[model samples]
Target: MLIDAHCHLDFPDFDADREAVIERARAAGVAQFIVPGTTRRRWPAVLSLGARDDVSVCLGLHPYFMEEHAEGDIEALAQALEANPQSVAVGECGIDARFGDTLDAQWRLFDAQLRIAKARKLPVVVHCVRANDPVAKRLRQLDLPAGGLVHAFAGSPEQAGKFLDLGFVVGLGGAVTFDRAKRLQRAVQSLPDDGYVLETDSPDMPLAGHQGERNEPARVAEVCRVVAGLRGQGSEAVAANSTATARRLFRL
Candidate 1:
């Protein structure tokens, strides 16, 4: 079974046909979906979606929408975590230097979530963009017992190695489908057996040739196939390995 270790199926893009979308994923060999919240307000919806047998949830503040997060948002996230003990992880949280306005605020928000995750011994589904060093630094400082994932990783070998050293796995998403993404493809190919997991980040990060279209968990099958091709193995082998890695990390 394949696990989409990161996605946003709770987002409005799937509101109309969410059930059918899930069925399609199941048909495509995607057995589990990790729907992570992008903000505190969306946690309810995320939790609602996660109520299904095949879905799990991760809640945190995404840096791209800084203005929407208020002062007590982190507290709200912590409460959400407490309220939904079944939630698999603590993120959708991390630094995104390329977007958003406040670097300081992003760090503070991410730091608060990390503290909660670390204290509760929960794994995080981190969202990092153009800020791997600072993100790695913070994770090292937290020294989380459960460790976490660096979702949609687009970095060099040295950077990916840093996250791996911190007990984190890289999430290969729709981005790896592009022929131009040779750097990311190489990283996926070179990672150790347990060093990577697969994600869709659905409704975003659409795969190559899927630009301007909606992405879905079902497409993770293609992602798994691409990774298998890169690693010179069969798709089922990559699926099993990545799914096992996700189950271990998210405790699914």
Candidate 2:
């Protein structure tokens, strides 16, 4: 009963055989997926896939793809969420300091989406890169009603605690499986049990040995296994707790 909590099955990467990809994940014990929308243009495809019983949808503007966002996309997102109450969360949104030029723009956009989530009483699925401090600061200030997920989190134990204190869960994925990710691995090992969630961010963050290849939800089981080993807990127990944490976070 594993859940891949941050996959992007809506992207064209799976257009040729989306159903088959899902079947493979099912075979690998992944029973559900949380597909977060990166931009408004991809919302229809995301909504289409989320219609399935096994998928949950989240809509937002990704900070990395700031260029793809339109002037009124935030308003459009609000309308979309209003029209689709079934949409569980308001994200795939957050700041990424990596993009120097769009730093200020990303903050504005991320804050706007956070406001929508706060108003709508829905959770969020955040994508952050090199900006945990500001993200935590803003979240503490905004205090969204439904706490969000810090998807694919790769930060220090202290940083993980900061986000958790601000009512967000840290998402650990394939990065934890790499030997070189000693800092991230240590953070995973020491972070409080209730402060974390499992995610794949599939079709993107591939596992250590599978670099340069297309990642899929099926590999989340492997993620669960590695994380369990790091925490010195049984894989089943780790999976159960993380799955429950996800269900709690997204109300899935």
Candidate 3:
């Protein structure tokens, strides 16, 4: 079975047919999902999804939604994690350079979540974009014991090596399915069997043929196939190794 190491199943995009979406994923052999919280307001929804035996959750503030985050939300996050023992990790949080205006606040929020992950001994589910080096640098500073995933990784083989060296595994998803993603394909080719996991970043990041459509957990199987083809390995082998790595990281 394959695990979607990072997906936002709790988002409203799936509200119309969440159960059907999940059933389809199960039918497609995608057995588990990790849904990370994006904001204080969304934590309840995220935690609700955790009630499912096959779904695990993480709590954090996403950098993309910096304006939605209020002061003291970090403390609230800490308390929420304390109260929600089922939470599997600490984020869908990290830096996104596209939003240059909020870069400073993003760092503050990302750093706070990293520290919380350190203190709680939980793995994290990061959303890095165009800032792998900076993210890696920050990660080095913390050296979190329960190293987490760099979700939807679109970095170079060298950068992937950096995260692997730091005890983290990069997540491969829809991005790698594109023919133009040659660099990412190369990174996939170079990853150790245990160095990465698959994700869909559901409700976003549609795959090659499904552009403009909503991505869902069921598509992680395709991600598995593409990654396997890139590595010249069988899909089953990729599924097994990625699943094992994800289970190890989240302790699920």
Candidate 4:
């Protein structure tokens, strides 16, 4: 069975057909999914979704919505974690220099969540962009207790190696299917299969042919096919290896 290591079924994007989406994923052999909380406001929704048999959840404030987050949100997250020991990880949190000026606040928020995950020994689901060096440096400093997945990885092979060395897995997704993503595709080809996982980051990052369309967890089989082709392996092999790696990393 395949596991979508990251997704956001709690988002409004899936409100119309969340049940059908999950069913399609199951029918396609996608047996598990990780739904990450984007902010404190979304934690309850995230938790409710995770309560299902096939889904897991992570709680944290995302950098993109940094302005909406309050200082006490981290404490509340800790309380939620204590209240629900079944939470699989502590993110959808990391740096996003793409927004330009919010760098400091982003770092602050990212570091706080990292500390919580370290303390609880839960893995993290990271979202990084144009700030790989800084993210890598911070991760080195914290030395997280349970290494996590770098969701939607679009970094250099060298950078990918750094995260792998730190015990983190690289998340491969729709981006690798694009013809213009030579660097990311090459990175996928070069990375070791055992330390990598697959995700669709659905309702986002749609594959090449599905550009401008909403993505879904059921489409992850296409991602597996792309990664397997890039790595000169079989899709079933990619699915098996990535599923096992994800389970081990998240203790799922």
- The candidate maximizing TM-score is 3
After superposition, the stretches of candidate 4 with alpha carbons farther than 4 Å from their true spots are none
Clashing pairs in 3: none
lDDT of candidate 4 over 134-192, digit per residue (tens): 88888989999799989999988889999998989999999999999988888888898
- Report the lDDT tens digits of candidate 3 across residue range 37-109: 9999999999999998999999999999998999999999999999998898999899999999999999999
* lDDT of candidate 4 at residue 110, scale 0 to 100: 90
**lDDT for every model?**
0.89, 0.90, 0.94, 0.91
As for TM-score, the candidate ahead, 2 or 3, is 3
Off by over 4 Å in 2: none
RMSD of each: 1.0, 0.8, 0.6, 0.9
Question: Estimated TM-score per prediction?
Answer: 0.97, 0.98, 0.99, 0.98
Comparing 2 with 3 on lDDT, the higher-scoring candidate is 3
Q: Per-residue error at 234 for model 2, in Å?
A: 0.8
The pairs that clash in candidate 2 are none
lDDT of 4: 0.91
